[model samples]
Target: MGKITGFMEFRRLSEQSSPVVERLKNYQEFMPRLNDQEASIQGSRCMDCGIPFCTTGCPVNNIIPDWNDLIYRNQWKSALDVLHSTNNFPEFTGRICPAPCEAACTLNINDDAVGIKSIEHAIIDKGWEEGWVKPQPARTKTGKRVAIVGSGPAGLACAQQLARIGHDVVVFEKNDRIGGLLRYGIPDFKLEKSHIDRRIDQMRAEGVEFLVGQDIGLHVPPQKLQDEFDAVVLAGGAEQPRDLPVPGRNLDGVHFAMDFLPQQNRVVAGDVLSEQIKATGKHVVVIGGGDTGSDCVGTSNRQGAISVTQFEVMSRPPEQENKSMVWPYWPMKLRTSSSHEEGCQRDWAVATKELIGKNGKVEKLRAVRVEWKDGKMHEIAGSEFEIKADLVLLAMGFVSPVQKILDAFSIEKDGRGNARAATDGAGYYQTSVGKIFAAGDMRRGQSLVVWAIREGRQAARAVDEYLMGSSSLPL
Candidate 1:
């Protein structure tokens, strides 16, 4: 520890965001970073605990204490090296990750935890500015070729790791550009596409070939991929959105969150929209109070919506957590995102009953208050109400990976419909079909980017060991 009393002397400090008014005008990242001296002070707040729960909390299992010490000592380059050793894309995680690590920090029991994510953000941004981050291609060739379907964080990490180990890695993406959800599903306000573009350039230089517009099970045949590559990795994400089947389910104004968010991202990227779903001059109601729903709220306000209301079926979470009960694990607490702050009317314990419309288009939403009892939800009596709404967005999370793709491969699926595969024992990540493996959302269901990257890297190691008798790649 640079200063043993740092945690007591200094409270946690993180990135400052752009003014809400200015940031809401454009779809650009707004988080301002701390200076080097400030970052070092935050790093020194790390307790250097005997058993670091932060590492365990992090999905990628980053060496938290080591990097914290490195940064506290002002060894910025070494901190980046240690960070990259485990995570292939710290920038993405630093920006978007929820930082379960902070919740699991030992200091969080009664005090503020170390600002690990902010420090990580500062370190990686500095690394890029200094040109310390560069592509390192393998020195020799393994001659084993691998094809990875989907170019999200998982597929990208897997391809990068395999390419670094002298293996031929090719990524197939169904979209016009790579980064799957990162490129499109996320708004440029949350994560700029430029970050994804720079990383794609680095991966290309390292010998990872990317083929866009290749939709397996639709445009690209599964058999063709099998025939072309020695092995295949299905990292395709869960794209099926969980739908709300209600009285006005087929209404003209109803749409999925993915369909709405991607359009704004495209417009921000300079793509012209002939005619689009505009919330301008209309009352917007968004269902499902998760991140996707929040994104929809932010987008609607930017589109000049008359007003925005977000509904959540579940009861409101506690503002503060019981640290003694949830220490070293994620807690149930209210999380208000930056988008929520821009301007939103949030309602919890509310359920949508129907959509009232005019001339086949939605005009209002009928909803009722809900109460949970005995693990089952009950609608409260006389609580029905109608609210003005011209646009309705279903922001409920995804249910599973597209069933068509799973059926095409003839791979068995778990109860949740995700590809049935384990991460341990013989043939880890291997599918029922020989020589085929699955990772990320395909195998584990929809999850965080960090978890997806971790699974992809581990699956790459598994595939490498399966191909060559032995392997040295880190999982």
Candidate 2:
């Protein structure tokens, strides 16, 4: 509303990225945040729509229009405050979150949606640069100890909220580092680790303790946390990756995307592995067409792979969606990520038949073209083909959380193997086990990082109310 006709005057402007040839040489963030003027212009494009669908579209329900107006009015610090009021880590969401908010924007019905993500990216980056982001340690202690399992976005968000509310919070991570997936699963090219590191520092200053290499169910028994802490929150993500059960799946060259992705991230963090999976000089085939698969393609191209190919079982989506039919909602359409633009041979509606290999090492992949009818798949006759593939990465989405952790605590599980917990009513986020709660992927299955943050924040409020008999924390 800062400029009434600004939406009509300005067009959407996306952030620029480094050239493909130049960026392929290293694992670093390619896209730079919009400059102050560009961000302000982008913010001004926010139309004064009667109802802001962008907020409802976002999992965290970010105050979009307010911040956009603030940015347009040159109130950078206030914009940062509005952003942090809802999102615990806008930096993470700003960098990696697929912005559903943009798809649901009022302007997206006919014209390009406002560049909300870029404006958010600029706001948070500027907040850090200007020292507007700092520790907000609680003034009074509640004397209640909370144990948070998993140090990803969910656990971290929960810990920060509880800590800032005067509760003693301790985050336990199985990995040797603080960030769980953020430190390992994602490539540095998409989101550098320094952002996570700085946030960790701020959390530490806020009185949240982080204990790395501490496996809760394994090294530290589940009973210890329940006995020691007043409350326990399980924010561990879904780690059980879906597998292709075709013959030769156990071949040496075939690996889960998690296995391959984390190693590269660790290497980028200066850890030298004794035996690491590399795509160097090999024909790489990444199965699955989601973000994980795109990550594999980018990493493979950077690792000097002879060739990189990506396969999606589903048919290719249209390049553009029919806005009239799908307006104010996320639409199914083609999305080419920065990794895809780097270099990748992409094919859709192809299903892998089997892995063809020599000497227990995968050498090629045999697949078939298939057609879908009435929600059923039918293989096309004589459409089988084989392609050279020295490395095959299974990038299909994760199916469930590791069952062992749930079993260790005797927690009830849903039909999908996620911890059984409700989001509303009494016993919200509470597991069957007393004093135990579940949030994020552990409760809702694998989802976006923004959803994880939303779950974490809400779970914190639930726990707060359970402890103090009342909570002022935002839901």
Candidate maximizing lDDT: 2
lDDT of 2 by residue, 255-362 (tens): 999999999999999998999999999999999999999999999999999999999999999999999999888999999999999999999999999999888999
> lDDT by residue for model 1 over 1-475, one digit each (tens)?
7778889888899799998899878888999668899999899999957889999999899998888888889999999999999999999999999999899889998998889899889989999999999999999999999999999999999999999999999999998889999988888888899999999999999999999999888888999888988889999888899999899888899999999998888888888999788899999999999988988988898888889999999999999998999898999989999989988999999999999898999999999999999989999999999999899999989999998888998999999999999999999999999889999999999899989999999999999999997789886
Candidates in order: C-alpha RMSD to true structure: 0.9, 0.6
The local distance difference test score of each candidate is 0.91, 0.95
Span of 10 residues, lowest total lDDT, candidate 1: 24-33
Clashing pairs in 1: none
Q: Which RMSD does model 1 reach against the true structure?
A: 0.9
Residue-pair clashes per candidate: 0, 0
What is candidate 1's local distance difference test score?
A: 0.91
Could you give me the TM-score of model 1 versus the true structure? 0.99
Badly placed stretches (over 4 Å) of model 1 are none
Lowest-scoring 10 consecutive residues by lDDT in candidate 2? 210-219
